[model samples]
Target: MNSIKPKFINVLFSSRLIEVLEFILEEPKTKKEIEKTLKISTSHLAQVLSKMVDMGLVDKRGDIVKILPKGEFILGVNRVAKGYDEFLSRFGNFMNTYILDDIPEWLISRFYELAEIEIAERREDVFSPHPEFFEHLSNSKRIYGYVTVFFKECINFFLRLAEEGREMEIIVNKGVLDKIVENFTEGFGKGIERKNVRFYVSKKDFQVFFYCYRCFLFDILLFKKCFFLTTRKIFFANLGWVIVPNSKSFIKAIKKYAPDKLEEVIK
Candidate 1:
């Protein structure tokens, strides 16, 4: 007698499997209810359900079919994988050099959330800040940003925002913070001293940068070694931006890299 092989291939090839899982995602359903709702015959439903059970995807007790934890996990993985694939397709070339591990596993698991992000790139006028970056900054009442590689224009832009009385919280690598203090002494004093702005100097090196505007998450990859939040360094502003319900999650993930008591930069 031959040993039985896993039924994942059968599950993968069957669209009915997804339909069944999704349909039962919220609550358990009866076999007859699934067959009626999905418009599948008794035989077809039987086959899909059997394979789902064998694959540890669902628990079927008589006619009551319920999704197991494994089933829910597979569903989540399927969605995130599609998003990650899309990201890889466009920026996958950099996958070799950039440290994917720099991203927390939770964020990686949620990459699908950013699969269809809006991109803002300033191609024609490379000298100006990214057009969308400016638009968001101008419109936003609040801003949260993390800077990895800095540009003079980017720092100046925030200084101007500070002057406008915009509420802003900034985190930067300690090295970049030093450069700002040394290069822009008077401007830094004026901008940073404002009560509306808060600055934190992170001891850890910036692995990936993000600029959060109006509770939005922004990312732009300049090179394998650098992830720029917003900058005029390349003379063009190209941002990978997304707004999701859990925008705070991205902010929280980045803040974890900072020290328990974030060192405030006093100009």
Candidate 2:
């Protein structure tokens, strides 16, 4: 049997249709119940219901209105669409900081799963979260990420973490890795011999000043700090960090970037 193709764009874009579908999704109700719930006139409610029934989305029996399978499917798609819309609205500022023109829309949409994104402002003379990010790195059992910028303080802590039997797989810029080889070669040697640390240099030219330890992920932007405008750059006092707890969706998103594959590509 051929399934009917619903023209769902109208339902997706129309708030009235979305609202009516949501109400019907909760439970089947009568026309009077929908009219009262939506605070719409009887004529308007009748028109909406009639449109839905003609589209094979709703079935009306006497005074009762029930959503059919087609209606339920449309509702499911709309929910996901709304989720992505909400994400873009809430994180417009955060996402706008990056040049994502080359990134696929599907991958960008998955970023909506990053819940509880936070933005904090810092001044030149005040404390910053660099210490806290490093502290969490030291506390974590395993760490994995790409780092385009290097700090002696952070390298020292990675050494300590390796010595403490923590596992780390890091991809760093050539210059950053060179600095580590110069300053921490002995520590890196010990870490490598113990099989607790592995490092690779990025083949492509790009900056990666961030960290990921277990469920916690951080990004440091490279913009300078100003007294007036908030900056998204890392390696500066005014930095923005995006942290997300472990969720299946989040894990799937990180995996798409294929940090592991990047590791092999470098070697």
Candidate 3:
């Protein structure tokens, strides 16, 4: 009589089989030892061991049971599957907001480096960034940004940083550049002349903001489409900021997306 072949999925899903394989993978063990560690009934253990041996996943030498090379390979695959499962679970909420393509390949590959993600709605608080975001700006020695608008406080912060010898290079909206000149012409004028800060105006209208620093990065996304928050009120859109700490890769990403050599393209 020929030995029956075990269904692969059924054997893979069998808790006792997995538990026994995991244990045996560590070291060869006798049936009595496995029973003591797993607390599985003798009959069930026998059945699972038989199926695994038939599938060429386990080898029994006298009383000692050890996982075969095939079994180790399967376990390695399972380990990878488990890691992806956990990664998906952790970032599921973020996925619901945007499709996979929206995320850059480099960032996606280094998803484990994510420090924080924030979404702020206008209804909740308009133009309000977290306190920590300001701290990052204050401490930065160099700043590069692609920006659309600025709050009064933000402009003031940049001015102070510039005074403290921080170098700022920004690609900004025309209105924002005009506002900075209008509000602080003398200070900004000196900063520009002294090469402490430089601004390039963009012709294309864009609302998203991106900033890169030595060890910090900010990605601020603003939605300004025909979406509505309510029947009477048109949706002003939320700002989604992803803050990354220890941002060497993030700096690279920012440079790639918002090139500093954008003077020729400035309109």
| lDDT score, candidate 2, position 192 | 64
What lDDT tens digits, residue by residue, belong to model 3 across residues 1-267? 998876576655566777888999988999999998899888988888888899999998778898999898777666555555665775565456545454544444444333223332333124555656676766666665555445656666667777788766556666667778788878777666546665566554445344343333344222221111111211112233333434434435444656652442221
Model 1, span 41-101: residue lDDT tens: 9998898888889889999998899999999988876665567677678667655755555
**Local distance difference test values of all predictions, in order:** 0.62, 0.59, 0.58
lDDT of 2 at 237: 15
Report the alpha-carbon TM-score of model 2 versus the true structure.
Answer: 0.44
Question: Over 4 Å off in model 2, which ranges?
Answer: 1-6, 91-267
Order candidates by TM-score, high to low. 3, 2, 1
- Name the weakest run of 10 consecutive residues (lDDT summed) in model 1: 228-237
Which one is best on TM-score?
Answer: 3
Q: What C-alpha lDDT does candidate 1 achieve relative to the native structure?
A: 0.62
Residue 259, model 2: lDDT of 52
lDDT of candidate 2 over 1-267, digit per residue (tens): 998876678888888977888898878998889999899899998898889999988899999999999999988888778777775675555556654453445434444444333343333233234545765665567665554445666667767777888766665656666878899888867666667666566555443223222343434222232111222222111232332323223223333544543433222
Off by over 4 Å in 3: 1-7, 101-164, 168-267
lDDT of 2 at 102: 38
Residue 257 in model 3: lDDT:
51
Better of 1 and 3 by lDDT: 1
For model 3, state the Cα shift of residue 125 in Å: 27
Top candidate, metric lDDT: 1
